[model samples]
Target: MESEKYNADLSRFHGMIENLPCGFFIAQAQKPYRLLYANDEMLRLFDCRDLRDFCRYIEQDVRNIVAVNDRERVEREIGHDLQAKSDRFEHVRSHLFTRESRIRYADISGRLVGTEEFGPVFYCTLQEIDIPQPGQMVDRDIRDYVVGHLDEAIANQWIQVYYQPVIRTLTGELCGMEALARWVDPHVGFLSPAAFIPVLEQVRLIYRLDSFVLEEACRIMRQRMDEGLPITPVSVNLSRYDFDLMDVCQVLEQTRQKYSLPRDFLHVEITESALAQDSAVMHQTIDRLREEGYEVWLDDFGSGYSSLNILKDYNIDLIKLDMGFLRTFTDASRSIVTAVITMAKELGIKTLAEGVETKEHADFLASIGCGRQQGYFYGKPQPIGGTLAHIESEGRGIEPRKWCHYYDVASMFIRQTDRACALFDRYGDGHVHCLYANKTYGEQVHELGYQLQDIEEDLGRPETAEVVRTFWAYVDRSRKSGQMETYFYIDGGDYVNTALQVVCEMNQHLLIYVEIQNLSQSNAGRRQSKLDENLRYLYTMFEDVYLVHI
Candidate 1:
């Protein structure tokens, strides 16, 4: 009776901590140390697979997630300042992961809250802070500085164009370029689109800005054509908030006649969010653009709820995959990517990748049936003057690039990711979430990466956030259990193929051990084909869906 009672109490004590609501942590004032103890909520925050994998993660999160320059300064302080300061408290505010891919602010405060009874220990809590609009880049005078010089700046042509070149992968030819709008107010020179776009959107003046850019682009394209220069289509992106004010087809039609250029010379890029909400209006608008003999490119593909049905439903001419997809490699991502490409091929749609940084990344995109890529690797977004200078200086043909092979990517996917791979900070607080995914069966814990929610939304799969305090009820019964693969119906009839493997991570967060089974398909036909079909289906849903060998 006594032995049984003792075991019950011990189990109950751990049970309480294991089921804690908040992300709880206990640590000593050690350097890059191990987690002494981490609660269940803490595990979800880090998306850590298990405690033993602590070496793979870090505490300060001073990696790229903290931004480039800020990390260096923080590290310098932690090294130089912490050495002299003893028993002193300090509050360090930095951006940390918020179980979502977005980097939200974290107020990490530390103090020596230890008594002789409690022993020598430091107590700290990392509370996530709400991020305000404009993303804190502007602290003083957001509008006054710009509004003060509205006319002089406009007249002086301070509003300039930065062309992000979009390249064709297969032929290594220049397909086109996307026109990114930039402004340099005399008072507040070199302002980000974020700072001013909100102002434009809020004040309902974005259409005016868009019109100026379109007219300017048409003039430039006509001039380039007249000069007998190599000019392909130039895409000008429009925001949904204001893009609807003007008939895109009508605008292009008029511009075509005025410039004596064909409709094929200009393209209109629309965002996924705008497209998803007003799809009916978009269908009519897009059809008009297509009917006018112009191309319609889906900008920021795979940025939001990119679903297979969403792909099948729309007939977009081009796919511009978001840059976030390249942040890391995972098996699921690899499969999804391959599927996206295959689906695009089946529909005869062109695809382009944004933010290609390295030769390896460029090569990977080309390998996965993506023939076009845009980013710093090919060339940075620059002014027309800069672009002409680069073309003239660098010579006017396709630049030769070597294909970089990746071993970290999953090799199982039928269509492989044929690009270079970059290291990502897989360990972050934002990747953590408690998904109460208890089916008719028992429940278990899972911590996914930051972008996994986007993945969930894209695949129309189960939200892996484990916080409803629902999955824990089964832990008491299933802790010492058999690991097995399971399938759950996600979003209507959508099926998420999950296998119970082992996730290895630092006590930083929980590791997710899932093996490749299949996706979306309801266990039909050959396994590989099912994998391929499901992947293709997912890609169709999410335009920029990519396959990594991750």
Candidate 2:
């Protein structure tokens, strides 16, 4: 009796769906998605004569009904929505292929359902909308054109790669460049990246575009090398689809190797939004990229609410400050940018400011110790051919400094402190050059009855000779052990404590950070008395007391 009622209920459900005005169908939940049933409206929407014709046109698979360009995105979105939401219903918009191979814009809604015969399936509704084209091309038209002509665009060189310079704030030299894609169609003239990039992303064809840009950038780098022109790292942006669709790290590595370029020559930039999607995969990809010697930068950082979370979860080499921070250019924005740069420095990550269009913006970013800057203030994005011509006319090209990274890192460290701190480059010849010193360092030197200029310029003064020698000795030990600290007496019976830390060593020169603290005057008398007592006790304890002098 129950079996008969189940059959009757199924029959009633089929009848109700067949009479509905809109298109309705049932499909398997899994891949190859066998189409179990389709209403007459669904057959008409697909331009099919009947149910058998519809099934045959779609190859008995619901997935076949979606246009090739939109299939992956539609499937991914539906699957993700089904897993993430408690509600059984999910909606997605995609372009579907009709029986006559015509593209139709569709709004699809599906609800998960269980049946005795099909086990688990999706009961889906499809609606087709005819979008009108205006004098200017609408988004639907652009998407259609891109979907059909993207491959042709790439092949015919309609897709062009352009580069914008990234300058080191301190040196005002080109430290890097960011590769950007531009579309120039013969039929449509020039198309804004805003118009095409998002469309490509929606259709999940962004990985191909990004790969094209990277390949073009590599070719440019090789050309520059062949011409003996100066070359710096060129950063290439990667879309999230790149990671989802292919082995992103493998692609990058293969491209770098193909051009015989250094791993650092091509930097990987992933936007914050991209990183937030499928963080597990992103984390693994980032790790693999870095492990292969590619510097992975978080592009458009601070553009989203999960910025801090991304920093916490992934190991990033640098962060590109979102241009939104500088768009309005308010005091509040300044404070926020400053705080972000400081925080990144403290976390041992570099920062680059974007949209630095004005002198005020550039000056402010430099004042705040932003490591890098990229904007129209430096140069606009241009093709490689144009860039080389401009450089030739200007008689110089952007060159990378080997020690700039170390210098910038040390400068940021010294600037953030209120203590007497300075950065020094120690040479093998027992001489040191001051790279940078904080205001507190100069004030402390003045308080010690010494001129800051004299201390930095010449340590050969009678009063400073011994101190300099001792400091160099500490520097040497720090180079071997990473850090060293000592307390010593200065000329005015003032005790001072000093620390030496090695930041990096390159070309036989060590970058060291030094901090000095002047002890309180009130403790001098007590310290002197204690020192005399200890000296006397040591002399008495040891029959032969040897003193080592510097």
Query: Which one wins on lDDT?
Result: 2
Model 1 residue runs over 4 Å out of place are 1-139, 144-152, 306-309, 391-550
Error of 2 at 169 (Å): 3.1
- Give the CA lDDT, 0 to 100, for residue 224 in model 1: 78
With candidate 2 superimposed using the best TM-score fit, by how many Å does residue 469's alpha carbon deviate from the native?
Answer: 1.9
lDDT per model, in order?
0.53, 0.74
Query: In model 2, what are the clashing residue pairs, if there are any?
Result: none
Model 2 alpha-carbon drift over 4 Å, by segment: 1-140, 326-332, 385-405, 408-415, 427-432, 442-453, 459-464, 488-497, 517-550
Candidate that scores best on TM-score = 2
lDDT of 2 at 524: 56
lDDT of 2 by residue, 415-505 (tens): 4456788777766664667766767878777888887667755543324576676766776687777755554544464556677788888
Candidate 1 lDDT over 1-550, as tens digits, reads 2222322343422223344344555454554432344444544545455443321444432142243334643333343334335654444545433323333444454444443432444444555444345533322555554555544555688888778776666445455777877775433334556556667777666776777778888888889779876666788877776546767667767867998987767888888877777457777877777877777888888878754555677778877776556557566765676677777766767777786766667766755656568876566567876765665564555332221111112111113422111111122443433221112111111222224345334323224443212222222223335343333323333434443422233334333333322233323524456665686578569855544543
RMSD of each: 23.5, 17.2
C-alpha-based local distance difference test score of model 2: 0.74
